[model samples]
Target chain A: MKYATMRIISGAGERTLATITEVRSIAALFLHALHGCFRPSRALSASFFAQISRQILYTGVEAMGLVGIIAFFCGVTIVLQSMTTMPQFGVTEYFGNILVVAVVREMGPFFTSLVVIGRSGAALAAHIGTMRVNKEIDALEVMGIDPVHFVVVPALAGMTLSMICLNCYFDMIAIVGGLVIANVTVQVPFGIFLGKVLDALSWIDIVLSSSKGLVFGAVIAVVSCWYGMAVNNIRAVPQAAIRAVVGSMTVTIILNIVATVGFYAR
Target chain B: MPVKLEIDGIFWSAGVFPLLRGISLTVERGEIMVIGGRSGCGKSILLEICAGLKRPERGRIVWDDIDIATMSRNELLTARQRIGYVFQQYALIANYSIFENIALPLRSRGDLAEKEIDVRVHTVMEEVALFNVEKHFPESLSNGQLRAAALARALVTDPEMLFLDEPVSGLDPQTASGIRAVLHARQRRRERTIVTICHDLYLWASRPHRVAVLEGGKLVEPEENHAFRQMVEARR
Candidate 1:
């Protein structure tokens, strides 16, 4: 009985140790990639520029349609649901506040991250993982090149830039969709709805939403890169992608939780 | 300027198997050293260790008296910049064009101007007898062409010590001869130190200055290619 108990305890300890090691490695890679951005020689390399442009196009611009459809439906449904429910509490004027908090401050960045992770994060992991398996990373190291600088920084920068832009686009489309729904059903005046949205949004709200976008973007990039480059063989490539997607999702939700507690606690 | 590489008391293992045991050798400046043995004899691992890409469990790789095992990351990188390693698989980035591939090492060093990169790459390309495929992708090039491109990239950096692992293994005889000719010309012209891992005896058209065989995890010094074969058989 003691031996079996000890075995189980050691197994749990081993898993916990693995998780900690993985997280530390990811954080270290993230810092190294960030440092690469400040090194003028590496930052100014043409490869960096090309990779960033490609990543933005692939991750951000290509994700617009899915984000648009989801945002539109989400906005209309939330507003309609609020109109039906909030009248009982006589809090109809708080519709704008609810929308601002739920959509702009939270859903915009969070949903965009989900979509980006599904679409681009997997690809990034698979691509880098394939490179690792092919010994291309080894080749770079042998040639005196830092793979994180050459490979990871551009992905990190591009995803962050794209997330910020996509969040804004998501918010704009969701508002337009909500306004259309309002005009069609309860005949809320376009000017009144617009005024309410504007009134509900403080600079702090905008800053918080944008912060979510930036942090979530960096999280996805770093997580994907860390998992991708960790792959050692062809069989491990798909596993890396799955691990990256899960890791990115975890980081995104964790950041969201922290932001929520931080803002609401005060 | 040529470089000296000394592999001293090298010992390495994989899992439960010992791959290298007390292997040691010295490649003098401007000397061409060729290492050979059977498959899985740790020839490639030794090459990687010598290049500081892999650290031995128990040994010191003294590249010009600086123990790479103890060198800082930046120092190791600086040391690697002066040594070029040609992978057996050619290992070119499939995403980059041939021109870009050849220009990679110089570009990564971040010291050469674009014009200088272009000139150096083109010169090496000519020397390797590869032409007019600068914009072509690696997949489009023939195997021999890809090997030539890999060699060109290695040489474009003007590394003092060149390490080629099975560089001419998959090439036709004529192409292999051409590759050997370029290596010979470069060795004499630049006085570069070279270490090659080869499987084919015919690939050594221009005999290396020193030939050694790796068997039973030790460097077996052979007087000639014929003797190298005897050493391999003796170990097996």
Candidate 2:
């Protein structure tokens, strides 16, 4: 029994090591491909443009309706919650600033990344996973075109650009809705609320939030592509795609926390 | 034509199960070499190994005296450009238009001008008689059209060797015959070496310069045309 237990433990250790090695290799492949994208290759350029168009369609246009509705409701809810609390503090005028800081600086990029992970990220994984399973990656290699240059670079470029654009749209709508809500519900003057928001909104906040958006976009694209390429079985593609989305969302939230702390640490 | 490919003592496996065990074969340029076996007989695996898509556990695949098994990944890729592969499911990029699908390899080549790419794509599409459907996506195409588009994509590179995996597996007889005719025509025109996996013995026997039989992941004896037919008929 002692011998058997040791054998089992050793087997498990070896399996874990193999998994870690595979993950490391995949991460290396992603970074290598990321660098390869900027190396002035003609194949990479065509794929990059193709991916940019796809990203615009998948991440920006498809997301507008959902983001718009969510932003409106978020504004409305923040106003309702603030009206109840601000009266207690006698600082009802600060509602617009609060909404702008919460929604624009924090919530907008976070929720947009979440939505994209669910929609476009999952689709990207599924599409690429299917390609891998069907030996299209091998086909690309056979044609002397790196799959990273042809497939992955374009996707990363497109998603990064799209995420930034989507977050910008989300911020605009949420802030406008918040101002309208403050005017109607709190009876705060719209001009005063707008002035406070503009004063309170820092360029640092926008830059940090957009930077986070870009990082999250890269994480989502890389994770999905890695999962897609790593899967061997056709039935495993969906599971890999789901894992990519869930893993990316969880990592994004954690990174968001770290970024928030780092930004406000001073 | 001279022998352009030689496989010596190839060994491959799918996980724990050995797929190709000490398999060896050779193909001369302009020859059609048919590998006939029942499903799961490792014929496709052999083709993939030959095409440098799969690495073997042991053995050497020499293409014109170059040992492909020992080449670097990029070198293997460059070697692959000289070989065309027609996948079992046609494997046309579904999102791309038929023309774009054919144009993909050329774009990757980075050698052809836009006009030249267009001309090559058009000529190949015409050769496969798929010029009329060039603008359509793979989803819009029928099985026959899809296979032809795939063939056109494979042929556009002007590969010296073509590897086909069950090219007519799921097609209707009419469509299958049409594909075979297109392949036959191309063979007549270019004299390219063709390596194909098929269970349809009669179809293969009619065209092949040589036939190899694989059973239980091992090549059986007597690899001549007459012996191959007799063995297939005996199995039937």
TM-score of each: 0.95, 0.90
For model 1, the local distance difference test gives 0.88
Q: Give the proportion of true interface contacts each model preserves, from 0 to 1.
A: 0.55, 0.45
Stretches of candidate 1 exceeding 4 Å from the true structure: A42-44, B222-236
* Pairs that clash in candidate 2: none
Winning model by DockQ: 1
Write model 1 residue lDDT over A85-175, tens digit each, in one string: 9999988887788788889998999999999999999999999999987778888889988888878999999999999999988988888
> What are the lDDT scores of the predictions, listed in order?
0.88, 0.81
lDDT (tens digit, per residue) of candidate 1 on B100-197: 99999998887878998889999999989999999999999999999999999899888999999998897998888898888888889989999999
Candidate by candidate, in order, the iRMS in Å equals 1.8, 1.6
Model 2, stretches more than 4 Å misplaced? A1-19, A43-48, A90-93, B1-3, B172-178, B221-236
